[model samples]
Target: MTTQKNTDLPLQGERYISREFFAREWENVWAKTWLIMGRADEIPEAGDFFVEDIGPESILIVRQADTGIRAFYNVCQHRGNRLAVVPDGSMDTFTCSYHGWKWGLDGACLEAQDAEDFTPNPCGHAQLEELRCDVFAGFVWINMDPECASLKTFLGPIWDEWAAYPMEQMTRVQAISVRMPCNWKTVQDNFHETYHVATAHPLGLNSVEDDYRLTAITLYEGGHALGVTQGSIPARRKFGDNPSLGEQIRMELQTWDLNPDDFQGREYETRIALQARKRQLGPERGFSHYNKMSDAQLTDTFHYTVFPNFATSINSDGMLYLRALPHPTDPELCVFDCWFYAAGAENAYTRLLTENGDASRLAGPAPREWRNYGEGTLGVILDGDAVVMADQQRALHSRGYKGSRLAHQERRVQQYHDMIDRYMEGYRPR
Candidate 1:
C-alpha cells in the first residue's frame, strides 16, 4: 500500500510516436517483461492452441497432451515461414504449408521434406524456438526473455491482492479488439489515472469518485501500479446532470434482490447495504468466492496496471480487462482489446452486469470478437478514449509539441515511463 507522487518526470512525445522508440520497446521492454496472452480456459483441451502477436514476434501457446501449456515462436525453422497462420484452433501438429516441415505441439521437429537432400538432417536436431511460459489467475503468460523472473515475482503484491477473486474460474463473456491510430502508450497512460473521467466519461462520475485526492495510486515493483478510488458511491464532484445513475443503481439493486425504492433518499447506503447483503446471501446465490473477498473489494473497483500494456478494473462480480498492444511495423497504429470476465457466470449478480453491454456480451464458450477502431463495438467509454488517442497522436507530430505536462494525479504515468527507461537502460540480451 505504498503511495508516492513523482510528477517531476517528463514524458516526451517522441517516446509515444517515434519509430526508433518503438524498436527500443521491442528490444528492452516488451521482450524482457512478461505479457498476458489470454485466459487459459480458451484452450482447455489437449492440442488447443492460440497465437499472440506482439510487434514483430508471433508466439504460439498450446495445451500439451500432458495438460501442460507450452509456448514457442510461430516461425518455421525451414524458411522462417509462420507455422500457425490462424489466431487459435486445435492442432495435433503444426505443418508448415511452405516446405512441409512438421512440428509437434511441444515445438519439437517431428518431420521434414527432402531430409536426404540437405548436408545434415534437420529433424529432431532443429526445434522450434520456445519462450518461457507460465499461468496465473487463469491467464497464460509468456516472457520472450528466457531469463525473465517468475510471473509471481514479476506480479508482486498485485498477485496476492487478486488471489482471493475467482479469476481462474471467471468466464470471459465478451472480448473485442479494435485497431486504434495511436501509440499503445497513449491508451496505457489514460488507464493509469482517472483524471479525465470527469470530462471524458461523465456518466462514470455517478459510480466513481473523480476527485484525485481520494484516489490512492499505488505503484509496485516491475513497473506495475494500482489506482484505487471509492466505488458504489455518487461522485463527490457535480457534473451537471446524469440521470443514468438511478437506473444503474436500480438495475444493480434488482439484480441483488434488493428494492431500489428502499434507498430512494439514501443512495449512498446502497453500496454498503449491497456489501452486507452479498456477504450474507452470497453462497446461496452461487458466489462462493465472495467469502474470500474483503468488504472493500465487494464494493470497490481495484484498477491494476500490469506494466507496459495490460490493465484490469476488477470488483467482486466482474472485471473489465483492457490491453493495448503495439503494431508490428506501424508506430502510429496499435490494437486495443476490451475483455470482460465475470466471477460467477450462473449467478444473477454477475449475469446482470455482463449480459447487456455493447463492449461485452454474455459469458459463454465463444471465440473473441475483432473489429476496426470506429466499429463502435468497444462501447462508449472505450470508444471515447480511442477518439482522444487519435487526436493526441496527430498532435504529437506537430513541431510545437514538446512533452506531457503531468499533474500529481498522473504520477503513475510518470512512474510508468520511468520504469520504461529502466528497462531500456537495463540488461538486454544481445
Candidate 2:
C-alpha cells in the first residue's frame, strides 16, 4: 500500500482557524464517513444503549431484543426533543420527556399522545429515523450518509491486516474524554508524525526508537497510514558506557524470567527474545491470542491512523485508541478521547505503559472520565501535547506564519490534508 507523493499539497494555517473550512469538513467528511461511536461490548444485553455526540448531531446506539445493534438519531419524532439525554443506560423503551411519546427498542413507535385526534394514528406506524450502523473490531460505527460505502469496504486492507488480533475479546481498561483548545486537525497532525516525539516526549526514547529512518511507515489509500516502531530498544541518540536497558524493558524481561544482564550490549535483540519467550509460555498463562499474531505483531508497536479522525497504537498485550472530534461550531475547539484496552484471561493482571509510568491493574471494563484541558492530567506526554496545541492554534493565526513546510518524514500529515481536499472536492469511497 503506497501512494504517489504530492509535494504541492498546501497545508495553510487558515484551515485550522477558519469557520468556513470547518463547516465544509462537517458536510463533506464527517457526515459522509463511517465513524466509531462506542464499543459494542459496552452494550451487551437487550435495551442497553449509549449516546454519542458528533458535532451537533446526537446518535443513539442500542442493543436490540434479538441481540443485534441498531442506531438512530436521538431526536424524537413529535417535538424533536432528544429522547436519551443521558450518556448511557438500559431502558425497555425510550420515552420522550416532552411529548410523552414512547419508542420501542426496535425503533417502533409504541405509543403517542392524542392518537385518536389525528386522522391517521402514528403510534403503530411511525418509527424513529435510523442511521446506517454496524459493528467492526468490537466498535459500534455509524454513518450519517445513507448511501455511504460499507464499513468493511471503507476500511480496505486494514480490515484484513487487523483480523489476526483478538481485539473484540480485549477489555477496555481506561476511557477518557478531554475538551481541547485547538482545532481537531491539530491533534490528527500531531499523531501523523513522530518528529515531535524526540522533543515533546523524550522519556519515550528510553524504550522506543523514534528515528524516522528506522521507523517503517506505510501510506494506504483513502488517507489511512501506519507506523511500525521497534520496541524494547533504546534510541540511537543516547550516549553512555553500556547503557542499561530501559526501566520498562528491564521489568518486562524480568516478568518472563529473562535476565536483562544477558542482553547488555545487544539491546536491539531484546524484542526477538521477548517474542520467543511469550510464544513459549503465553498459552500456559492464558494469553492464547499470542498464537494468532505474527512475529512483528508480538513485540513491535503498530500505530495506525484510520483516515480522518482516529488512531490506535496496537501492541501484543494491549491497544491505545485515540480519536479527535470537531466541536459543534468552533473550529478552534475539539473533543479528544483516549482509551486503553488489555488482552488476557478475564480477571488477569496486566501492566499498562502510560504517561504516568508503568502501572499494574486488573484487565476489564473501566469507567469513563471527562475533564477540561487543564482540570486534570492526561499523563505526562499528553499533558505536554495539550499545552502546546493551544499555543499552536494561536500561532497559526499570525500573519507572518506561512503554510506548513513538511519533511519527508511528515508525509503522513500531508497525505491526511490531501485526502481532506479530495473529499471536499466530492471524492466518495466506492
The candidate scoring highest on lDDT is: 2
Cα lDDT tens digits, model 2, 283-302, are 79777888888887877789
What's the residue-level lDDT of 304 in candidate 2?
92
Each model's Cα RMSD: 4.0, 3.4
Return the clash pairs for model 2, or none: none
Which ranges of candidate 1 are over 4 A from the true structure?
1-7, 239-245, 346-363, 427-430
- The Cα local distance difference test for each model comes to 0.81, 0.84
lDDT (0-100) at residue 82 of candidate 2?
Answer: 90
Q: Which consecutive 10 residues in model 2 have the weakest lDDT in total? A: 346-355
> Which structure among the candidates has the greatest TM-score?
2
The residue-by-residue lDDT of candidate 1 on 68-186, one tens digit each, is 99999999998899899999899889999999999998888888888878767888688899999999998999998888878888888987888888888788877888888889998
TM-score of each: 0.93, 0.94
